[model samples]
Structure formats: C-alpha cells, structure tokens
Target: MDDEPIWDVDRVVALTPSSAITIPETTNEFVIKGNHLTLIKGNQLDGRTKTDPHKHIHEFLRICDMFKYRDTKNEVVRLMMFPWSLTGEAKTWLDELNEGTIDTWDEL
Candidate 1:
C-alpha cells in the first residue's frame, strides 16, 4: 500500500543523516525504512495507553516521523535503520551529484 505525499510545512520536517530524532515514549518497537516510520503500540495492561483507537494506527508515520529530503527524482528515499557510518568521500559524492558534475552512479 502507498500514500501520496503532501509537501506542506506541517507535514514534513527537514532532516539530515546526523539529526537526532526521538521515537515515541510508549512504543518499544520502532521502524525506519524507505520513507516510512512505523511504531507498534503495546498493550499497557494498566489501561494507560490505548492499544489503538484507530484501525490503521501503524499505516502511516505520525507528524513527528515525517522528514524532508533532497532528491532529483523527488522519489522519497529514507535512511536505513542501521545506517552505515558514511566516509568523508560521501560528501564529495554528494557535491558531485548536486553540482551535476557526475554523470553516473559508478562515479559515486
């Protein structure tokens, strides 16, 4: 399933790879995949947090999970959960891509 993106201010937050973002307080499970953030609510048993009042609770990211990206295709791509520490060469690669100095991914 897919949901269309709306690039409005209230919808997304600009982010960099180094940005530190918090997952929800109650959730023990968190997921970050290609342009998606998913949180699985738990049963508090004490009736503190509702299991899920909505049907599609895990279907989309909350407002906090949304982030901005810089892509030419405008196809949303997200950082992987276990991000590999990038080398300094990544910046040079980004510079080349941004400046249109590289013609192919092999140059990266």
Candidate 2:
C-alpha cells in the first residue's frame, strides 16, 4: 500500500501564492489595534447579494482612516488590512491570484 496511489488523486497539492500587495515595512513598535480589526471584520464583503462594491470600499477606507501609525503610510495600512474584510468566494478569488501581480491599492 505504501507505493499505491489513493483514488488516483495527485500527490501534489496546489498552494495559494503570496499576496501581490506589498505591505510597507513598519517599526517594531507599530501595532494594529484589536478594535481596528473588529471594525473591518464587522463590515466584511462576502461577494453576495446586491452589496455595492464601491460602497464597501468606501466604508473600508473609513475604517482604515480611523487609525494612523508613524512607521507606515495609511495606504500601506489599507493594503495590509483590506484582505481581512473578505469572506467565502471573495476570499478564494483573492487567494488564487499570482504572487507579485498587484503592487498597489489601485492595482488591487
């Protein structure tokens, strides 16, 4: 059995690539607060129904605006935090993109 293939399934599994969005370097002292994550999670976009993508983005920006860090730009923060607000198929789609494909928020 050690040499046998199980159900003809491939031995190798495809992995999700690293995100193309570059997160800016931050000082060791910089920390994203729990409330910030909470806010973003609260307004998650699951890619269903009549949810307005533009409106969702605006709300996401508003949440990102609530926090500031001296070591990193606000745009960097938005890029780092945006992925936390997706669920289901939306998340799957993002995870499937090739690494280094998106270098900026505008590209995303």
Candidate 3:
C-alpha cells in the first residue's frame, strides 16, 4: 500500500471541534457561531498581520476537509497551530490545500 494517510471514523469525531468550518461567502467578516463558520471582507483580524479573513476561512475549510476525511484530530490541530511540525497525513492535506485540490466551502 502507498504510504499515504488514510482517514478513519475515530479521527473525524475527535477533530470536529478544534476549529470552525468555513461557511459559504455570505458576509464580510469572520463569523463563528455554534458549528457555523463564515468569513467576511478584511485583512486584519485580532491584530494579526498578513492574516486575511478569506485565507483564514479557506484554511479552516481545508482543516475541516481533513477532519471529514479522517485525518487524526491531534495531528490536524498541530498542523493548524504549528505547520512546521507537519508530517504524515497532516502533510498530505496541507499539500492538497496548496495544490488547490481540496474543495472550498461552496464546493462542499
């Protein structure tokens, strides 16, 4: 078998709450209520530089996709918090994101 990470049921359930999934474009600011996540027009959020709301939303969507696919919750969380530590399946998802293969909120 290939050395790719395969998602399983346990991982999906475990990582569902670590972050919010990106909701389809509906507003111009970041929105996170209950399990609904949205993003609006803006570049600066919580005083973080080079942090675009749209990009953040996309990242969340990617993470959500990883979770949906069964990537380990802990590894997914680590990738979001510390990308430098990316390895195994987490790295695969990151690569997919970079390659624009992961589906966007609208696509989902």
Best-fitting candidate, scored by lDDT = 2
lDDT of 3 by residue, 1-108 (tens): 333234431432222322232323332342223232221212112213323436654655454444322223333332333322234454344433423332342332
List TM-score per model, in order: 0.17, 0.77, 0.21
Candidate 2 minimal-lDDT segment of 10 residues: 2-11
For model 1, the superposed segments whose C-alpha errors exceed 4 Å read: 1-89, 96-98
* Segments of candidate 3 deviating more than 4 angstroms: 1-49, 69-108
| Candidate 1 positional error at 10, Å | 42
Overall local distance difference test of candidate 1: 0.26
- The count of residue-pair clashes in candidate 2 stands at 0
**Candidate 2 has which clashing residue pairs, if any?**
none
lDDT of 2 at 59: 96
Stretches of candidate 2 off by over 4 Å are 1-15, 27-29
Clash pairs, candidate 1, are none
User: Tens digits of per-residue lDDT for model 2 on 11-71?
Assistant: 3434565875677666656777899999999998776555556888999998899888776
Candidate 3: pairs in clash: 7-70, 28-40, 28-41, 29-40
Candidate lDDT scores, in order, read 0.26, 0.74, 0.34
